[model samples]
Target: MTTSNFHGAVGTKAKPVTSQFQFGPWTLTAVKSHILESEGIARQRFEGELELPQVPEMIFADNVLRLQHVAGFGLEFNALDALKLVDAHNDPLKVAVAQAWKEARADCEHINEVVKPFDWTFTTEYKGTLIGKDGVQLKVEPTDERIDLEKLKVREKIHFYEDILLFDDELSDNGSSIMNVKIRVMPTSFFILLRQFMRVDNVVVRVLDTRLYHEAEKDFILREHSYKESKVQDIQGPPHIVTDPNQVAQLLPIKRETFEKLIFPSSSISQKEADAIR
Candidate 1:
């Protein structure tokens, strides 16, 4: 068994969050606990992807600790209750779960196998487009406007064509260093067009969020395009950026509740109009 771990400064807490861990029959789940300990503290987001083998047995357990003065951290964990999986090839009690684990493992193995052949390279020809909130199309002159490709060369960044790949060290199998790739895209006019053909809005949302477009850009779209319609309401004001400087580097999704309530309620236009613009 192989394992991979990648760490990013996710708002200061040492806890991991939203990592596509390299190897595991199971993954650390979302933290159900959100206790605040300090006045200037921020919450941590913890999540993981799991891969379990066929006919396996496993158990999960945890231990909690209390901190004392000087903010001394106390730790507790049930190592005996560590990730475990039992083979249930014949047991009637484990048929469904066993089969599910088998399927999940198979999927992960396939992805690892397929992705291994890829050599990380900068994408210059993979032309991307951007669509605006209103329906206007923005001309994407890659040669002139491709300013971001250089910033990606910095430390802790690896661009995999359309997204950045992050590997987990603890869960890697067969020395496979990659766990998953995350894409960063602003929901511009061209993106909307691509979304139609690629179905990027659904599956892609897990890896990238398209709602990061600027209000000025969105307003430019509304002014240039004539069609306006939406199931939800339009946005009245600009997007409220997350102010915490620590979280700026971390990828996060647009708050769905906030999106529906504030932004989508006002600016979204009709699908028919969207089609006409295309």
Candidate 2:
């Protein structure tokens, strides 16, 4: 994806916000915060970061077998962000940032919520498929609707780590950054697929080229050519599938509910709103 510079949002200052995130077995520190300014107006904003542990060789190997392949935002709101938004008196930029923060938290909640973890068996029934060429998909009825596999932009890549003999989901070195606006917005869009595949905690399943969508019915399908395929030679049999999350963590450190929280951040709802919900 290409990023285009936009006007109207001239950045005046950008400093890292102090924040930290704890995911499963790892701890991440806050990098920085920035105060964005436009039209002679400025508001403090926390630049988002994805902090997770480096994947262990074992986990990396596990992911290679199947295919390769955030936080720090609490105290702010509990202290003043909520009241600040209301106090901003509807200043467009301030209100926008406040709402955006809330939305981000909501994203965290949606991903890590308990609705599914306790009953992951329901994920096996999802029929949706994330269509990233030879990437991965859901083989059964979907447990959650947060991610729409069919909606993902299908991009191609070369298999770098394993041989064509090993048929697992091929990781894309597409070089897309998580902070990429599109990904930041729907942070969980990709993981909902993983969550659907994960049956146990601290683990996520990654499969590619296993379920082929056809004129028939429920089965995961992923087919990617290591190289171009001649019309006459429809080489088959390398389509692989692996059910584990270690590989995924190397790329993005997220375990089931934590992952849910990572994407649908609880910050989406403020202490006031949460109190209201309660």
Candidate 3:
């Protein structure tokens, strides 16, 4: 049987998290492992895309109104894990052959096919725990309690995408030699950022990029954009930024215990009665 026929051999295939990963201030704890799936049978036919989950609107609205900070948890990109893919596919022997083919203008597309196993994708569900700055640990349950808690339906979803394509030639033993790599955080990651501004102290998203050409000083560049509290003096954009990633990780609905203790704003009265009282 060809490799294309069976991608069913299932188990987590990832490298250990490197020390370089800095998740800013929030502490994350995960239960389940990240799952990797190949996009195609071979490198030539390979096409990959990140999967996005559908979250309900009520999840965002319900908690924001309560003035409580919602923490983001679950699976996010592991830049370090991608190196595993680069290392496997970009073997020196394979790179040499790919180079030879291009130099000779030869047509051997199997190179792409043989390297297909190295092109992989991962999905992380919102099932984990996050500790806020105040030391409150919210245990995120997988039951997806938005509907029952917020009276909100998840009719649509936010999306963020980063496509990493590693040709057989660009791959390397450590995945550092891989080039022409495009790293991006989709527009959908900014929802949790509101928490950073309104209540939390730190928030950030991670990105990884590999090179496509020789003479690149580094194998990969790890970068991240963090949110900071700033006051905007002009309208050119937001006080801190002009645009933002789409939001994710809505605050959990307020519980009965916390709801009863909130200090509500003063009730409104019509202006006519106020004028007479004055």
User: Each model's C-alpha lDDT?
Assistant: 0.21, 0.21, 0.21
Taking the tens digit of each residue's C-alpha lDDT, what string does model 3 give over 57-159? 1111100000112232222322222222332332223333334433442333433335333222121111112223434333322221111212112232323
Best by TM-score: 3
Kindly give the number of clashing pairs for every candidate.
Answer: 46, 40, 19
Off by more than 4 A, model 1: 1-129, 144-172, 176-278
Per-residue lDDT, model 3, residue 231, is 17
Comparing 1 with 3 on TM-score, the higher-scoring candidate is: 3
- Global CA lDDT computed for model 1: 0.21
In model 3, which runs have C-alpha deviations exceeding 4 angstroms?
1-25, 29-46, 50-70, 73-76, 79-98, 101-278
What digit string (tens of lDDT, one per residue) describes model 1 on residues 198-268?
01111111111222111212321111101111111132222221222123213333333112101222333
lDDT of 1 at 92: 22
Worst lDDT 10-window in candidate 3: 57-66
User: If candidate 3 were superposed on the true structure by all CA atoms, what would the RMSD be?
Assistant: 23.1
Ranking by lDDT: 3, 1, 2
Query: If the candidates were sorted by their TM-score against the true structure, best first, what order would they fall in?
Result: 3, 1, 2
